[model samples]
Target: MSRSFIIDGSIIYTNYSQIIGQSKFEELLREFVDILKEKQSPLLNALNAFKVNSDYDVHRFTEYLHLLTMRNIKEIGNIIYYVNPKDLERFIEAFYTFWRSKHRFMVRNEKYAEDYNRRASIEYTVTMIGDQFKATIKNLYRELMMNVSNTFPTVMRQLPSGAQVMFLIQEPNGEKYRKNEWVTKIPTVWGAIFDPPAIFYTKSNKRRGILPVVEKDILSEIALDPNEWYRFAIYVGDLLMYNFVHVEYLAHGAGLANLFELATPKDLESREPDGILIFGLPADKIPGYNEKWRNGVIFKEEDGYTGVIPAFDENDYFGYMKKTTLTIHNLIKIDRGKLPIHGSMARITLKSGKSVVAMFVGDSGAGKSETLDALNRLEEVAQIDTIIDDMGSLDIIDGHVVAFGTETGAFVRLDDLPPGFAYSTMDRSIFMNPDQINARVIVPFNNYNEVITPTHIDFFLYANNYTEVHNDEERIVFFKNPNEALKVFSEGKRMSKGTTSETGLTNSYFANPFGAIQRKEEHHRIAEHFIKKMFETGVKIGEIRTMLGVQGYEKEGTMLAARALLKVIEQI
Candidate 1:
């Protein structure tokens, strides 16, 4: 016996060997088909597979399986359909295509690429930032021009000494004219001119408007009349000086703003000028008597038994300081090669020799002021002319040192000074003006005080934080300690052959701190290379060379400093 059954419209059965007959099988097949047709009452071609009971049903099942496999293949193809990229393809093509929907892969044209980038918003933003800075300068200038026009009257009343009064028109040179012909011979004044106090009248011709003064010839005609000449100079000088004050203020404010706008505090602090002029209180006036007190300091008492102890209470007071408290003026060394202008703290080379120039620096405080005051006092006591005092101008002429102060003044000893001198005298050294009647009186104190430190040359060394760098590139040396740097530069003896050329032996520095010169020969070679580079770059030019020897033009001094600074590697 054989049993046959159909499941899921497919044939399944076991063949029997004994009872098999064609007529019987045919009959059974007809019966199964009738049952399947009854199960599906409605006639449907798609349903015909269900009514079938033959080998043909197997062929139908095979077709269905093939269709199901095709569906799965389509699903997989949809999941990971991607175009293959060529090995020669550039990243830019992929980048542009990723960013821009309209982009297509092709060889990019240089001109088109440039044009596209130029039109980008990022480029526009950069261009706008630059324009903004320029505009700020213009606005500042306009404001200054208006202010000067309105405040001319006030400025005339308070003109500073050393102020120059200029005129718009200069008098023409001509043959000598009689003093009495003043009205007729006087040049017509136009633009702006300073008014002379004196009429420049001859002793022989004493009439008003009768004698007129010509430029530079004002004193020649009246050699014996210096008093009158000086009076006339001041009157005219005042008028001319006022004219440019507003313009200069505007330019300075704009430049300074631009410099500080983007600078961090560290950047500003790190900016080392050619020299620094310290004007505030002396270092000894601070709570602590130590090198650490140079910047500024605070005092705090440790936990103790209730109130204060006698001598021990003094020891409890200490100082804490920040580097910013120090008042510093950056020196713009001006000499023959440099020009002078407003905002310039000139670093003038003394008449002293080059070796001395390397040592003389400007710093005044308890540690330095007292020691220098002693030397200066000795000269005064000995009735020896102390050639220079506060506010001296230095110039080197024909390899000779020349220094003369703005005016004669007294010198004070630091030891006799009251405690807390640093906090007491903030603007004595840098901003004092002789015309202001603000004379610094250095009265001789015969009395001695135990609180003051005794005189010692070593104080000048430790009180000053000196940093030296050798400019192998420019063959120049720089000293940074303000109080003693200039003095050392001015007085330091030439190093002997056996002395090592370290910071202690020679006060020279490479503006670039990271310069590599471990060996003596390497140092020499680097120096030569730097000198050659500087020469090629016009560092030897009159303006650029001012910083080379500590004395040069006043106007171009900062440029000199910046040039030398390009070689510095570290701060001392």
Candidate 2:
């Protein structure tokens, strides 16, 4: 009546007649009995080898046999046609393979042993202690002193609109630091932590940059320290719209504070943070840092707020820091049912004094910023004001679609810009890993009001940076149908320009993963409503192929795209 089995130390019972028909159940039982009589000794040996302590493992084996029998009966003639000595041996081997694959501890242990041996084989030898050695030791001591100074509590006492930020250091031997989950998973490397890299960009010379890690993994990897001393409070955005980030860990707090506007401790204590970011412990401390899912960055949407946790070191701080802000903004925007587009937006005033606000939606390295920056420099476009450089939101305001910027500063790629542009903003810019190909700079180029204020959008365009256009007419294609326009906008298609790990051509829905991807239904509803309204209001919709992403055609493609954009503007 009832069949019982053990799996992973747990007992599971099933009613054979209820699960499989009575006839099939009897047929399987008969087959299993015959097999036991013939191969009982070998099967028992195999079970013992697998450490099967209970009867459930046997039942599980019978279940597998039943399924296999059923499959053979349906495919071939009858149960007698398939169940034999040869097939039974094959089945046993297949089951062993499946079990071994699932139980991978043995494999992992061997891998760990290999890695330990490899690391142990490396040699580090010291020669005679000459003048050079003495000087090297002295330089090391000086560098240690500099790190000590830089490791002190960094406080930003004042921020615009009464926001402040502070980074308090945690004691090395504190109970909170030692007892955290992340600490337990990963061993702490104090020397590596104390002497972190000065730059955060990737070292790759290729045009495509490092791929961004998933946000959820980054958040889940964090293990918060109980001590409040390791915490920091910062205010970001502006008074009209702003959010507070109460983060744990000095490096993450410092990285974020440097990237965005800071807020005061008092403001954070009084106001609920729009998002919370926790950097639990360093990546080196995590046990399985090399695993695919454990890249140490994660984001989660909670009740009334969003949260982000990133496991990043000093060398990758710039990229992760930017991601933290973008992730938070995206979560908030999606929660509020607003569309957050990954692109650059600007308000351009033509020579005729007609001002039009446009949003160039695309992934990174899609020429969104470059095209906007080039247009800003053109004499025909006399005045150009940036709303947001990286990420922003689109919403309906006063019955008209309006665009709002998210940050006061722009985190721009150095390789994309013309020579001398980075130097011009050096006074206000924070350059990161300048020697690397995908180096970055954060500069306060746009006003806070310009970033936060809602500007009426007159044009919506996709920056087609990688597509090949045969003629000038093909460079820009206007969408006459709203469905066609929505399709293009939703597809978010573009060629990879090495800003991320993706190669060749890739596409994202709405060219936005943060906001649009999170709330698909809401994004669709908002986008459809906006697109229909734009058509009715005479707002232009089209694509501009900059060809900046293509190799060997970067300059020529950009020029051609720019000229085409200029022509489109002239008609407007």
Candidate 3:
């Protein structure tokens, strides 16, 4: 029994002999169909058995089908009886051309339509969701994932230091986390996903490392929504930093929003962001975590963009918030080529009616803020206006050294602050882990205007609280040469007082890793040039040994530093 087959809606078979008066091309087609039928059943069964599951499988199957069809035609041409070779050849060529063209068209059209529909559906969904939650509470992730525009709903604000920032958020797909369980892996772009770090109650405790991101995995990580997240535009020194982040809870975002003076949608309309920081935090422990995530925070710089992703954990009261903010600041520092110093700054007025803007550079527990707070309490000091307490920028503008504040609020260590300080700002502050040793509060200590304005730096001093001063009158050592000033600034040496995991003496480039370390050569050049310029302008450069890093000398050091600072202000 001969098999039957259909070709272009015509029935053909090996045994059927209706060849009389039929065109040679028709005869050829009948032969081809008969041969195809002989092999079709096995091919169909094989294809069915190897079901098209993934895109790769579908592609392989399509290629196999095309090859099989062409082979069958050729086989039939050789076996057909009484068929003219020239006629057969022409028919084969025409059929091949048609098949190829049809296949190409179908593949191209299908892919194009699929992409277009997917995009359109996302846009339509975004519009619907945005409209639904316009006035009420809404999940930003939902709105963004469905959004048609590449740009998300953004917010911008001017930092205290006159830098404007914009935040761009990428929303993750809703089903991504649901499908993977709530414990989805932290996106690789935002540092390595790892188990919790070893907690040490001892001094000199090494914090967890931050892993560099695998650049190739960034997009995939961004698309996965492990949890709800928020993006922030906070002014860090001279750059406007954008932070795309997910915290374990909404309260963290709310707290930071209040602390950073987050801009509204209306504010974003007028400003452009300077740099970006993409970060992700998982609520629960990540299962089967990548080993790279345990390495630590990763800093990436590409074309006009700079960013970092720190390792994240929900209960990490220190590194999670602290390191993430530092990463963002460092990114901005790299982007803007500004000097980010770990310090406190203020505009002080002396009893003699002399006003000077002074910056006290130091590490944590080095009494930078405490010294300034003490200066504010001095009777000889007329008024002391706080500019920035944690991090700030130093820039050379028009041949004059100037300082700018980063945050409007201060993330001060509660243990070091005056007894009533945290309580005084409780209404507008967010206290994190108050029961812990390194308890922190974000309070709006200064207005936005006070932070952004470029203030001429009249004095630059290192808050050397670790150094013991036997002679209190000779506590302040003035540098005669700019090189000497640069040496001290570059050393950034300070004693650890348990504000962080570091114990004993430690040093960072200019007491800052955020800006100075990222751009060492640039910062050094700027420092040299600015120091000389400041010296020529008669701006005082010196180090004041407050000894505040010592246990029993906190009050004594503050008093001595305040009195010396008052004298310096009077002279200026």
Candidate 4:
């Protein structure tokens, strides 16, 4: 073929322009016809082997594909539509599944990385002179539109100021989507493609600064096509965070935006954000920022809010976006004399009309969420209202420690839950990497009002997922002293169950590496003040050994912990 593209799994990428003229575009299609004649592709090989249609052989396959556009494919990138393949939908789906399982797409070009994924697929004009071919193409497109619509790869929101923050969701799937209440049962791949397997983070954020240089490299590109992007707003706990996302990472931004409350048009008009993120710049192309930014870094913006730019656009992970937003929110909370916790909080109401707000603090793989999930499953429980699933802040309201949630949704691990947990909520979940390690499911657990509103804390416990609970009494234990409680929480200890790159015993400062690690001394003072206040105010503090990290106790330990919690609640 005169025109070439690097076939990366399901993607056909090329740095050079494919559109030369009508004649050239037709020639390219002719080349594809030749390639199809050999029945080289697995889908074609199987089709021929089965002899699905004896009337037409591989050489006569050109009739199936109508020449799309006679222009260069560079404007929006290359795409292939299956059209109305009828029963072949499964076979075609299998074709894509086979390629996706093989390897991730590689963009091969050493320079000029395309600042986009999820290449836009549009309706082809079918400029060929032949009426038969044109009619076939038109009918296929009509049939295609009836089933799906054009959706972007990145989830984007362009601000009125033209600034944007876009979240490039990693390996999006059609199993579920995030809508109002994470609407369920819609498995439409309207705007997503099968991305390569996601890898564990080799690098994590480790640096912070007072003020960072405002970047323009990405801004310049967005200026070239200002109308292309979409827009969004967020309230991270109590702080307003505005984002202007460039169009390059469109379609998938909703997954990221759903983590927080979507600001109303009224909210956008009345308030200024405490933090702002301008996304879409390629990390490799930008200059003067710290080299460690490639690793991950957060800095104060000139406008007084925390600023975060994705470290790398190429082969990036959603963690960079998720954590950066959390870091900024946590930092603001820290500055405001509030305590940000890397934990989970739930208000559990027993069948006897007794309710208690239980707060579990620990790092990843610590069973903070698993124990709460277990409590929800108990028959004696009325309902467990989850105030926070991962990150939240502690504040003194009316002389009592009150917990506020950070995220509107829950990004949960599939392997940790009971067998049917994820599948049962398939209607309102975004399933990611379900076939791989650290497979996760993101679901909207509650609404914005519930997240931002404060809930009083009754039982403050450090999750001890690594420890073995030999008996019911051992499942939950009080620290006996405020200092002892402080000492335990300060250590931030947990046993790694492979949620991250760590193994064995691990300790993070106050179980939060996002913000406190950057301002340890200040956070230490805050933690001490809060710990003593909780003790003084009659809030019971202790540890619950869910043993989620125990080699064989993953499921059983959480149940034991839940039952013990129930017993404790009943006695009170």
Candidate 5:
């Protein structure tokens, strides 16, 4: 308490005057004032979060003055910090003086000491944030090696354009680098980074149980924590829902907002939500359901809305946040007579203006993304615009099976990508556990308008990542009929590439475990209808042998399959 700063977990908040002087805040305001007068950017707009006296000519710096005192400031590592620019001699001195002493206290903890003994996985800072922030702001990052542990979380999490967080520099300064601004959040950091005993997430043990009809409100009896409740209204292909997430898992939950369209306030206010998903809640918070799911998630139809709750964070993986959100989306699709697909889709165009909308359906590690990436690289393929990267839905519109995309971004495996692929989009990507196997990069590739628009399927092909086709023509084999297509698709088989918990050969119903597997009966009825509609509508159905999971094939197999696809599209 004598330190004049409130320390909660990894976050610290104190009076502005404690670290930064009044002159620094004013100097900061002047720079942003200049930027607003000359240029505009999504980042520069963080200042716009503060209201302006619209009628005033050169109104006093009253807003900035109030900000200097007002609490609830926020920080995103050095990428975005609230006050006291990282390079300011004051900040460097203040932080070093404080954490240096605290390090002694923290090292006293046996577990902290043990973990510190292990390598800190410094590679994250090297590739992702080391060059990212320090190079941009003031270029003093590497010199500040001691701060890596606390800085990593803030730099890696990408915020949506208008999140309450603000951009520094467009607003503040550290003498010569006086153009820097820092975001500061005033609220208490409650349960923000508490590492509870969580299950290691593996695809194998995570079971799914669906309750067709739940008669009562499961949450009615428990006392819910209000501060922990945060809402993310996202559109998974227009199936809009309010996802209420627990603050502990909120960062990962917010990842869903990055991929899917975060529903606008206008829509959220006007339209009724199609579903309500509550993620990261303790089983005790929802008493009635724990008896059913000892470890896995529970998908149930409650009062006309679908719900999915992952009872535990066993694996501490991003997949929990992603898959649970998809499950809610898919279940809603199942109820609305649509088929939720776990696959990749794109719109490829040739030089002659000929366009083909191709869909490669498969489970995780079946080359849904890798094959499509390879397809984009083909010389003859003039342009390939991705429509859906991971999850999508098939609906019968005007008696044809039309597909709608569920995500604008992709949660792509680093190893599956072609050389220099992930780095190509480094600026827009967020890397998760980069030093470990099954590392991934979450990058927003397409816009919401592109993915949400209903597009007809030109080719509905199953991704055969396991098989190698030597002959060009043999790379893509057409299904004899709808039954054959249904048989191959429903019996979703693929060689696991260690991207998931499963190893070697595996089978998932329809290559989709999200909601399709949870509500198989309903999904089957819907799948049959859509596949039949595809055949009736003359949508080319077949299997593209990517050979991505096949030994010695890898990138070559995908390129070969892509070549075959180009020829097939031209022939069609």
Candidate 6:
């Protein structure tokens, strides 16, 4: 039997035709165009296909397409034969029987229902794909939150513009995608190019991927909110100490490097963005919080990291921020060769709220050490002890002044020290070669000396003129100009000039009560009175420590000395 077939969409043409080629579906359109140009159809060549055009053909095509849409394999034909018959009833019955037998297996195939639901139309496939994209973006946001959980609740106050800062990241993604993909590089690049903020505060929330805590939160938490001072103090101290020590901003981990974007108040107000995070805090809460952070600067690494971090329950972020400012001071080499060996004199004000004899200057080999030696033995001198032999630091603390003396008290008994330590201690001195001195030519020099009291006269003289008291009258002068005062010393010969004595030829200025005692008396009065003048100036103990290179202590000592000096100034 040569069975008839219908092609509803387009005729399988050996030559191109109008509506059939144009109106066909895309795949079918291409097939029709190719077949028409070649004058042969791929379908016809492969399966011996033919086309029929009529209402009956159209009806048949529609019926077949519907079965195919349902994935009814048996209903589809492996071979369709062309037919011409005048007895239409007999032909129709035979055709229907053939169709029913061909589709029998398709009806029993379990996938028929499944194929109908899935391949019903193109719209269903597109809707499924859209849902998948949404889910991916949602997950990416979650991952960002998880990474930033560690530095959450970060706060800052009084931040300057254009300060580079960082956020903290705890859990980073280990996915196949690059970190940039997750962070959204395009937006980050735009932020950097247009506006950069001081720093970022971020933390990984366990449930989320990463969370960004930006400039607004920093300001409100620290600058605007009163309760958040402790948090503010922590970050501020980190900022200040980092700035002070490094003189530059510190970069945290790599991801944090890009994430920090701080904005200024002006940026925020204009809707331009002042900072990244903005908390709505009141104005009154600002000052106190700011002050707390300022004070937190005094805390050490341990205090800042351990005590403060735990206090706020923010150990992760706080632990990483550096807390102390580092300052290095270099000491000048002491000239051992120079004498009336150069004696240094600085005003020392004691904590006892009293000013006493402290200054000493001396001529080379003149017993400067001996005078100090004498004072060291005195109970009074022992009370207002020396803080440093040569150097120290001074810092302010709570309006009080304190000192760190590098050297042990001059009275330290060498015998009491361990043998190893005693060897290094500067407790003993050697004096020799007195006559080898160049006596005829004097190397004149000038220096400012610290004389706290008239009692300092003995020490200064002892330090200056030990072996020989030159005829130079060592007396205090009321004349303001020091050069002119020294000029008077240059011009003079002694009154009550010395005659030969049993010991040696005596210059009366060296021993005569009139010259020696008179000058001593004058210097004593000046020493006692001059200290009162110095009291008007602040002197500190920490200054003593830094000067002397005291062991294992500088920061604390500096603060104490500074405070002490201020107090003294106030009292004076």
Best by TM-score: 4
lDDT scores of the candidates, listed in order: 0.22, 0.53, 0.52, 0.58, 0.58, 0.22
Best by lDDT: 4
* TM-scores of all candidate predictions against the true structure: 0.18, 0.58, 0.59, 0.67, 0.66, 0.17
Q: What is the model-wide C-alpha lDDT for candidate 5? A: 0.58
Task: Rank candidates, lDDT, best first.
Answer: 4, 5, 2, 3, 6, 1
Which stretches of model 2 miss by more than 4 angstroms? Answer: 1-255, 280-293, 296-317
Clashes of 5: 24
- The TM-score between candidate 1 and the true structure equals 0.18
Better of 4 and 6 by lDDT: 4
Residue 85 shift from truth in candidate 3, angstroms: 99
**Full ranking by TM-score:** 4, 5, 3, 2, 1, 6
lDDT of 6 by residue, 56-128 (tens): 2333433332333333223344433322222222322333233222101000001111244543432233233
In candidate 6, clashing pairs total 84
Instruction: Output the TM-score of candidate 4.
Output: 0.67
Q: How far is candidate 6 from the true structure (C-alpha RMSD, Å)?
A: 35.9
Q: Once superposed on the true structure, which residue ranges of model 3 sit more than 4 Å away at CA?
A: 1-221, 224-227, 247-249, 267-272, 282-296, 304-315
After TM-score superposition, what is the CA distance of residue 433 in candidate 5 from its true location, in Å?
Answer: 0.8
True-structure lDDT of candidate 1: 0.22
Please list the residue runs of candidate 6 whose C-alpha ends up more than 4 Å from where it truly belongs after superposition: 1-354, 362-366, 379-382, 390-463, 466-480, 484-572
What is the overall TM-score of model 2 with all chains considered together?
Answer: 0.58
Better of 5 and 6 by lDDT: 5
